[model samples]
Structures are given as C-alpha cells and as structure tokens.
Target: MKDTEKISLLSRLVAMNTVNRNEIEPAKYLKQLFDDAGIKCEVLPVGEDRANLIAEIDSGSPILAISGHFDVVAADAKEWATDPFTLTEKDGQLFGRGANDMKSGLAALTIAMLELKAQQVPINGTIRLMVTFGEEVGELGAKMLYDAGYMQGVNALMIAEPSGYRICYGQAGTIDIDLESIGKNAHSSMPALGSNAVDHLIRVLYTIKAKVMARAAGLHNAVLNTDTLFNIDVFNGGEQVNTIPNHALAKINLRTIPEVSNAEILQIFHDVIDADAAKYGSQINMHVEMDLNPVVGDPQSKMLQLIQRVAKPYLLNAKFSASDQQQNQIVTKMLGRELPAGTIPALGAPGGTDARRLLVDQPLGFDYTVFGPGNFTSHQPNEYVSKSMYLDFIKMYEELFPAYFNEA
Candidate 1:
C-alpha cells in the first residue's frame, strides 16, 4: 500500500474510540480487515464489552506470533488540540490519542498482512496476529490468553509496542501493595485517648522508603531513584474532622528488578508493618494488588539475528533495551537492604507491556521480543505517529514473515 493509504488506515483506527474501556469497536473493525484480507480471525472476549482479536495467515507448526494491543489509554478532549479520537495531520505527524501509542502499530501489521496475502508469499509455517486489550491496565488480555493456552507452540513472538524501531529484550517486574491500619476511634478533642491510624501508617511507609534508599546507595551499575521506591497513590482515613480515624488505608507501588523476588519484597513489607503494628497496638492488613514478573529475551539468539536482518535492508537499526529497566533498578535499590553484588544482567530493563504476561506465565515458551515503529506517547495527550514510520514498519513485517516461517 502507498504511504498515504497507510496513514489513512491508521487515521481510521485512531478515529474509533478504542480507548482502554471501549475496545469492542476497534476489535470488530480489525476482524473485518482480516476477513477482507482472507485471513482467519477469532474474537476472544476478555470481559464485559472487551475482546481480543486473534488472526492467522496460515495454521501449522513453527508458528511466528505478531502481537499488538488494541486498547489505548484514555484521553481528555480538552487536553488535545484536535479531537483525541480523530486523526489530524500537522507538521508531518498524524495526531490522535492512539496514533502513536499503538493503533499505528496495529495498522502497520494489518497492512503487512494484506500485502502478504496479495503477493501470495509462500509460507512454510504459520504466522499468528493477535490484537489484545487491557495492556495499559496490567496486561489483562495477555494474561487471559496465557491462561487459556492460546500461545501454544509459538517459535517466536513479536510485540509491536512503540519503541522507536528498537528491540526490547528485557523488562522489570512490578508489584503493588495495599496496606490498612486499624485503631480505636475517639473524639479528636481527646487525641491521647484515640489511636491515629494515619500517623502509624505514615511511619511504616517512611521506614520502607529508608530501607530502599539504603540498598540503592550501595549499588554501582544498579542505582535506585527515590521516585520509584514506593508510591502512596491513595490514602483514606477519618471522614469527620472532629473524630480520630479508626482506620486508614494506603496503596503502595513497587517496581522490582529481576534480582529480587516478589515474595522476598512482600516479606520485607510485612515485617515493617508488623513492627509498626506492635508499637501502636493497631491491626494491619496487607494485600498484593498486582504482580508482574520481569522478562528477558536472549539478545544473541537466532531471533535477534533474524530481526536485524529484516530491519537492516530498510535502514532501520534495532537495538535491544529492556522496557522498564530504569524504573526497576531505582525501585529495587531503594527497597533492597543489602548491596546486591553481582554483574547486572546484560539484558535490558523492563518497560510496561503485555509481553510480560504473555511470555512470562504462558507455556508457549517462545523467545519473545518487542519491535515496532512510533515514539513513546502512551497515556499522554496529543500522541501521533509519522506517515513514513507507519509504512516502513509494514515493509519490515512483510520481509520478516517469510524468513521467520521458512527457517528450519
């Protein structure tokens, strides 16, 4: 397809309000596109009004998986210069909510499938295309697929996340904790008679932060930043001004490096809470909100060599960087108490994506890497992708499939 046509396709995808909450419309549209291209497609419903699209060029062994998320982050209409859902061109950039963050990547893959179908590219193995939902909200769709065993027997998996044409080979794990403190309620006038749950909770949070910072101070290659150590996103306490709160809840987010296990960190947090509870005579409740393990693809594997070969002819250089290494390193440094003495793994750090759930928990056991066009604009206002970048990505996919499928 021509560059303009490719941009137009991306524009249509952006026009559809496939924001994280409403992905059905785009899922339907994409299914139709695959149908028109004569590719076999299926819609896997993830939950109420949410679905995932799985299509295949052909079905058989040595399957190569191409994946992208159909959902985009929510956008505020007032924050955007143009309608956030409508694609507009300005200064050579296609501006829209989903344009750059990923709808463009989905379009690029769709167009490649169409071109490959028209050319009747001889395929020795199957190529699977999956457009998933809820990647922005903890990779829900990917987890669902992994649970259902949809990724069985995949030789290689490629996720088209916006990475500026680079390859992502490693990422950090994420763990969220919710802690609540309970104490006896009493009138504010008699402050000494009542236990202040909020006060005790703050002390515990501070302790956790200090522990993380101490760990970070000892690392050389793996430095921790205070920002990623612990985040108290939500705090709730007494409803009335005159009364001391009997209960307080705080939510903490911890992004962990591959060096640490979620279980280990959870134990540390529990110990901190237990000590605080003992001093205050307050009940402590702790729950894990989410746990996403880190992922790393082999950089020297045949997959990396194949991707480089496919991208080189188009003058696109692909480098492997883990998606969220910086965030993970900083968080781990702050949370870990001991100086972790070891050569930091050669793999790149983790960034947030559905690849985590798909490859980490799933039995597919395929070597997974993320490569795509577009710059990083996820969850931001006025995101966009270039017309040239979109089309070039299509060409790359077209070249990649045959080689990947024909390999013995």
Candidate 2:
C-alpha cells in the first residue's frame, strides 16, 4: 500500500478508543479487514468486548507469528496537549495515547500482513498475526491464549511492542508480591494501647529494602545487565485519622533475571516477613500475585540474522538514495560503498511485555523477539510517534516477513 494510505490506517487505529479499557472495537475492525483480505480471523474470548484477535495468513508451519497488543495503558485525556483519543499530527509526529506504545506498531504489522496476502506472495510457512488485550495490566489475554494452546509450534514469534527498532532477544522478568500487615486498633489518643499497622508496615518496608536491595546488588544477570530489585509500587493504609490503622497493604514489584527461581524469590520475602513478624509482634501476610520469568534468547538465531540482512539496510537507506551515497561512502569499504550500517538490534529489552507470559510460559516454546515503533514517550504524558518512523517500520515488516517465511 502507499505510504499515505498506510498513515491513514494508522491514524484510524490510533483514533479508536481501544485504550485497553475495551479492545472489542479494534478487534472487530481488524476482523472485518482480514475478511476483506480473505485471511482467516478468530476471536479468543477474555471478557465481554475485551477479546484477543488472531488473524492469519495460514500457509503452513513452522508458523512465524507476527503479534501485537490491541490494549493500551489507560491514557488520561487532561495530560495531553492534543486529544489523546484523536490522532493529531504536529511537526511530523502523531500524538495519541497508543500511537507510540503500540497501535502504530499494530497497524503497521497488520498492514504488512494485508499487503502480503493481497500480493499473494508464495509462502513457505504460516504467518500468523496475533493481538491480545490486558497486556498493560498483566498479559491476561496472552496467558489465556497460551492456556488454550494457541502459542504452540511457532518457529518464531515477532511482537510489535514498542521497541524503536530494537530486535529484543531477551527481556527482564517481573514478580509482584502483595503484602499486608494487620495490627490491633485503638483510639489515636491511646498511643500504646494498640499497635499501628502502618507503623509495622514501615518497619517491614525498611527491613526488606535493606535486605532485598543489598541482595539485588550482589545478584546479577548478563541479559538483564542488572540485579533483581524490589519496589513498593502500590500501598494502602490508614482508613481514618482518629484511629490507629489496623490494616495496611503494600505491593512489591521485582525485576528479575533467569538465574533465580520465582519460588526461591518468594521464600526470601517470607523469610524477612516471618522473622520481622515474630520480633515486632505484628501480623504480616505475603502473597505473590504475579510472577513473570525473564526471557533469555539466542542472539545467534537465524530469524535475527535474517532481520539484520534485510531490514537493517532498508532503515539506513530509507533516507538516502544511491546518488547521495556517491556523495559519501554509504555503499561500503570492501573498497565498495558503505551500505547502510547493518545493525543487529539490541539483544534484549529492559521492560516486560506479553513476551513474558506467551513465550516464557508458552508451553510449545516459541522463540520470541520484540520490535515496534515504540519510543521512550510511551506510557507517559503527550505520547507521540514519528510518522516517518512508523512508515519505516511498516516497510521493514513488508520486506522482512516475506523473505523470512519464503526463505525458511
């Protein structure tokens, strides 16, 4: 498709209020689009109108699944310079909630798949387009797909997550622990008569911070290039000012690497909490609500190599013509011109995505990597994506996937 047409489609996707609050509209739109393209579309149920979409150019295995998440983080309308729901163009950037975080990536990949089908490119294997919901929350949709056996026997899974152009081979794991402290309540005036749960929680936080952070400093993983650390991301305490709070809840988020097991990590937290409870005479309870193990990839995978061989050149050369190369050494130095600097994308990603749930926990074991038009601006105020970047990514997908499937 023409670039203008592609941009128009992306703008429409961004215009949709699929801000992860509801993904049904986007999924329905995509289903119709796939039907028009004569591709098979399936809806996997998650909630009412909160379903996941799977549209496929099902040729045969090994399937190369091109995936994205339709659900986006909730965008506050007030924080944006332009309407977060409306795709606004200013200074070559499109400002919208899901513009950078995903919708753009999703649109680009979807367009590529449509184009491939329209062209009737002879496919050697299947090219599946999978989009899920609840990614921003906890990858609930992706986990459901995994449970239903939708993530099996895929040779390679390419996620259109926001990654700039970073070909991620690995990513950090996330573990969320919900902790609560309950103590006897009394009137505030009687200070010593009742234990303060909030105070007890503070003591626990200080203790765990010291222990976990210090332990984190010592524990390192090469892929994550950092130590696993914990943070009290969500905390609730004290219902009234006049009474000593008898209950407090704090949720801890930990970024982890492959070396440590989730069970072992939970045990560490329990050890700290149990010991402190006995000493402080306060009731402490811990439950790990989420455990997403890290995804470690083989940098030497053929899929990654194919990406370098094809897409890298396209990105570098997109801005310059051969005549411009004659102005410089862009062709090569094999005594040749410097062909666009061939880049092997970053071997891993720092943040987590559905890759954690679908691939790490995906039973059939799909080799997964992440790429998209996402930038640092995602999940922040005034989120925007460069129109040019989105265009480049779509073009890359167009050229790369066919070669990947056909060559394989």
Candidate 3:
C-alpha cells in the first residue's frame, strides 16, 4: 500500500467514535478491507458494540502474531484544539484520539498484512493479525481471546503498542480494586442515629494508605528495577450534603512489580476490609476489577536481536521530531542520555499493554516485543504521531514478518 492509502485508512479509523468500548464498527471496517483483498478474516463479537478482528495467512508451524488494540481512552473534544475523532495533520503530525496510543500502529499492521497478502509472500509459519477491543479499560477483549485458545500455537508475538520505536521487552503489572461501604442513611443533623458510610470508608482508606501504600513503596523488583506504585484515584460517598451517605465506594489503582504477587495484595485488602468492617460495624466489601501479571523477557532473546538488526537503519537515518514541544524535549533528553542514533535498547514499559493478557498464563512463554510508532502523546489532549515515523513503521512491519520467518 502507498503512504496515502495507509493515511486514508488511518483517517477513516480515527473518524469512527471508538472511545469507551465502541469497536464493533471499526472491526467490521477492517474485516471488509481484508475480505476485499481476499484474505481470510473473522469478526468475533465480544460484547454489544465490541468485537475482535482476526485475519490470518495460514501456512505452517511457528505462528508469528501481530497484536494491537483499537479502543482508545475517552477524549473530550473541548479540551483538544482539533476534533479528537477527526484525523488532523499539521506540521507532519497526525492528531487524533488513538493516533498516538495505538491506531497508528494498527494502521501500519493492516497495511503490512495487505501488502504481504498482495505480494503473496511465502512463509514457513502463519501470520496472524489479532486486533482487540476494550484494551484501554481492562484488556477485556485480549482476555477473552486468550481464554478461547487463540494463542495456542503462537511462537513469537509483537504487540504494536506505542513505544516511540523503542523495543519494550517487559512491563509492570496492574491491579484495579474497588471497595465499598454500606450503612444506614439518616439526616446529617442526627449523626448518632445513622452510621455514615463515608466515615467508615475513610477509616479504611486511611489504613490502606498508611499500611499498604507505605509498604508498597519499599517493595522493589530486581528485574524491572522498580517499586510498586499505589493510588486511590476515585471516591464516591453521598448524593446530598444534608443526608448521611448510606453507601460509599472507593477505587484503587496499583502498578505492581514482580516482588509482590497480586494474591498477596488481595489478601491484604481482605484483611483490612474485614478489620474495618468489624471495627466500624459496617458492611465493607472489596472487588478486584482487573489483575494482570508482569512479564519480563530475556533482553538478549533471538526475536529482539533480529528486531534491533532490522530497525537499525531506520532509527539511525530517521528524520522526524514530535509536533508537541514538551514531547520533543523529553525524547531529545532520552536520546541524549543514550546517544548513537538508531540504537533500539530493550527496556521495560512504564505502562502495561495487552502483552500482560497474552502472557498471563506463561510469563516467558514466547519471544515478545512491543515496538511501534508514536511518541509520548498517549491518552493526552492533542495526541499525535509523526507522519514519517508512521510510514516508516509500515515499511518496518513489511520487512519484519518475512525477516522473522527467514531467520526463525
């Protein structure tokens, strides 16, 4: 596919309102593209208005997979200078909601698959494009796919998560928790008559902050060289100020390291909530919203080494800067610290990706890498990816698939 066709596909994808779990339409659109090219594809419905698109070029053993998500975080148009749903290009940057986070990577994957099919490239293994939905929220689609035996024969996998061309071999795990307190409602004027759910929940929160948060900071992971970071990001208590809150809810998000298991964290929450409930005489309940394990691959793995080799020329000869000034400054500093352009180092991703879902059962099951276009504009207003990098990624993917097959 030409650069224009790639951009056009990306534009149409961006124009679709896929925020907050609406991905069925986009899945269908991609299916049509594959169908038109006479490639075998299927749209697996995940939920209402949500689906996963799987297209494959079947051959033999050692399946090589390219996985990416189509869902994007919520974008408020008022906060963006341009329409968040419309792909806007200015100063060599394509701006949109999913432009940086992942749609650009998805577009590149799509184009590469089409190109490979059109050229009738011979391969010893299968090439599968596993596009998922609801990755932004909880990786629900990825979980569904994994549970349904989609990854049974995958020998090598590349997740097209936005890495600014950096080779990511590992990522931190995440646990989202929700805690609620239940009590009797009463007027604020009569505090003695009714139990305040907000008060009860606050006590629990204080205990968690002092006990869990304090200890998490000291728990370190030797492999990733990081500590668990915990935060209580949401709280809901009462509907009106004049009445005592009969119900209270608190949401906690924790970026975990390998040092502590998710089960250990849950145990701590259960102990704390049980104690608080007993002490306050209020019904306190806890639920695990999502739990994903961390994965760290061998930095010197054959897959990564091959990727580094294939990507060297592009990285060294690349000519593009971030459209956002702040983003450019950060990238410049990072590159300065690790000089010699075109050098792709294997590093741990700060944020989690679909790799967590894919590798949950076996952390080191396969050679995995998260490499893609776009800088540090993910989930922010005015998200953008340089046109040069986006196009280069398409070329990279085209070369990468066949290169892996030849070398594997």
Candidate 4:
C-alpha cells in the first residue's frame, strides 16, 4: 500500500473502539490485515473477548519482536471536538482515541512488514509482530505472554509506544497501596462515645505523606510525590449522618523508584498504620493493589545505535533532546499531577508501561528499546498522530531492520 493508503488504514484502526476493556473486534481486524499480507497470525485469548495477535514473518533463525498494545484508555465524547472513535484529520493531525497512544505505531510496524515483503528483504532472522491487549490496565497481556513462553526465542525486542521518535532506555517502577481504619460506632448525639475512623485515617495518610516527602528530599535520581500517594478514591462507613462511622477506607497509590522494593514500602505503611491504630484505638488493614519494578535497557546497544543513525536524517536541523521529557510531561498532565521527588528521575515515566515487565521478567540476552511516532497525547480525548510522522516511522523501521538483523 502507498503511504496515503497506510494512513487511511490507520484511520480505520483508530475509528475502532478497542478501549482496554473492549478489544475483540480490533484483534480480529488486525488478524485479517496480517492474513491479507500473507503473514502467519495467531490469536491468543486473554479473557472472554480480549485477545493478543502474534504474526510471524518467518519461523526459523533468531527472532526480532516488534510489539504494541491494541487496547486504549477510555475517552469522553464531550471533551473532544470530533468523535473519539472516528479518525478526523485537521491541520496535519489525525485525531481520535488511540490515534497516538498506539494504533498509529502498530500501523507503522504493519506497513514496514508489508514493505519488506514487497521488496523481499533477505532477513536472516524471524520478525514477529505482537499486538497485545490490556496494556492500559496492568501489563496483563504481556505478563500472560511471558508466562506462556510466547516471547521465548527473540534476539531483541522493540515496544512501539509513543516516544516522539527517540529511543527510551529506562522507566520507573509503580506501587498501589490501600489503607483503612476502623472504630466503634455510636450515635451522633453522643459525640465522644465513639471513635472517629475518618480522623484517624487522615492522620495516618498525613504520616505517609511526610515519610514519602522525607524520602523524596534526599534523592537525586529518585522522586517522591506524596500528593498522589493517598487518593481517597473509594470510602465506606457510617450507616447514616446521625451515626458515628465505625469504619473508613482510603486507597493510596505509590510510584516507587528502582531503589525501593514494594515489600519494603508496604512494611513502612504497615508500621505507620500499626502505630496509629495503637494510639487512636482503631483497627488497621492494608493491601497492595499493584506493584511493578523499574526497567532499563542498555544505553549502548546495537539497536539504540541503529535507531539513532536512522533518526538522525529525519531529525534534520530540529533540536534533538531526550524524547522522555515530553513523554513525562504528557503523562503527568494526563494524570493531573506532578511527579514526586525521589520517585525515580523522570528518566521519562510520568506513567508506567509493559517495558518494565519486559526488562524485569523476561530473560536476558535481548536488547529492548521503545520508539514510536506522536507526542504524549496518549489517553486523552482527540489523541492523534500526523500522517508525515507515521510515514517517517515506517521508513525508520525499514532502515533499522537490516542494520540489526542482517549478518556480516
């Protein structure tokens, strides 16, 4: 297909609502695309309707994996000027939900494969195109792939997450925590008769904030943002306004640096809760919602060098800087907050991704880097990618394939 045709194909993909929870149709569409291109594809089921697409160009020799997520975050129609699920082109930008976060990247990879087939590039290794679902939730699909040994024989991997054309080498870890406090109930008329669980919970939250702040203060590469540490997302207690609440719960999420383990942080929270419970006559319960370790790729890998060489000409006279800066800013804005000090140097993660899972859980020997088109418009209404940018990405991949996979 011509570059324009490729853009149209991408627009059709963006129009499809593959939002994390609902991705079956998109998976089927992708399988059809691969089949038409004469690529062997497999649909790995994750849940009832959620599937992962793995298409292989060849089965023998060392394998090179190119991956992206099919799922996108939910979007609100009123917030966008155009339909969130329908691609709209305006001022050189293609707008729609999942336009930039990933569908565009996936299109680039798919087009590159088509171009290779048309030219019959003599590749010494197999090239696998992996489209996974549930990246927005937790790296569920990636975890399943790893556990199922779907990623076993790759020599190298590239995650086409939007990096604004720069290679991403590292990302911070994440931890989600929940803390609750319980007290005896009493009638509102008897003010002092019953303990105030809400008040106790606040005190504990404040303590955690302080500790996180203290940790943030001493770090150079790490950050600790306490403001987001305790998000009172859901709360339950008190039968009525007249009754003193017997219980209260607060859900806190912490994004940690590589230096801290989730277990260590959980212990700290437990200690604080225990102390508060002992002094305030309340019961404390804590649970961990999610925990992910930090991930970093080799700075001087062949893949990194190849990417730099391929991107140099496209960058032209444009000032080049680490792509992570914009990525971090975009993520922070999406979350409506700033990262905390000591958290992890914004090596470029205002949010986490499957990259961490690939780096930490996958076995060694393969180099991994994240490179893709578009800026940080991921997860927002009217998210988009420019046609020129998408085309450039395909060309970049074409140049890279030979450098990394062709033997001497």
Cα error, candidate 3, residue 112 (Å) = 0.9
Report per-prediction Cα RMSD to one decimal.
Answer: 6.6, 5.5, 2.7, 5.7
TM-score to true structure, per model: 0.85, 0.87, 0.90, 0.84
lDDT of 2 at 342: 54
Candidate 4, position 391, lDDT: 81
Model 3 misplaced stretches (Cα beyond 4 Å): 185-194, 214-217, 222-225, 238-245, 322-337
Order the candidates by TM-score, highest first — what do you get?
3, 2, 1, 4
Ranking of predictions according to lDDT = 3, 2, 1, 4
TM-score for candidate 4: 0.84
lDDT of 3 by residue, 1-408 (tens): 677888999999999888867799999999999999988999998668999989998888778889999899889888999999899999888999999889999999999989988998887788988999988888888888898888998888898888765787888888898988898889999988998999989998788767766667667765455688778899998889899989999999988777777777777888888887777787888888888888877777767888898889988777756344455456446434644666776677558888899888767535888888888879999998888989999999889998888884
Which scores better on TM-score, 2 or 3? 3
* Reference-based lDDT, each prediction: 0.73, 0.77, 0.84, 0.73
lDDT (10s digit) by residue, model 1, range 244-317: 88889998887765455556677778888888777777677888889886666676656666776666645433
| Candidate 3 structure lDDT | 0.84
Query: Candidate 2's residue-wise lDDT over 294-386, tens digit each?
Result: 887666666777777766765565453233234234212312322335554545545887878878654122466677875667788788887
- Using TM-score as the measure, name the better of candidate 3 and candidate 4: 3
Pick out the ten consecutive residues of candidate 2 with the lowest summed lDDT.
330-339
Q: After superposition, which runs of candidate 1 have C-alpha atoms over 4 Å from their true positions?
A: 212-228, 239-242, 316-350, 362-366
Q: Candidate 2 clashing pairs? A: 330-338, 330-339, 331-337, 331-338, 331-339, 332-336, 332-337, 332-338
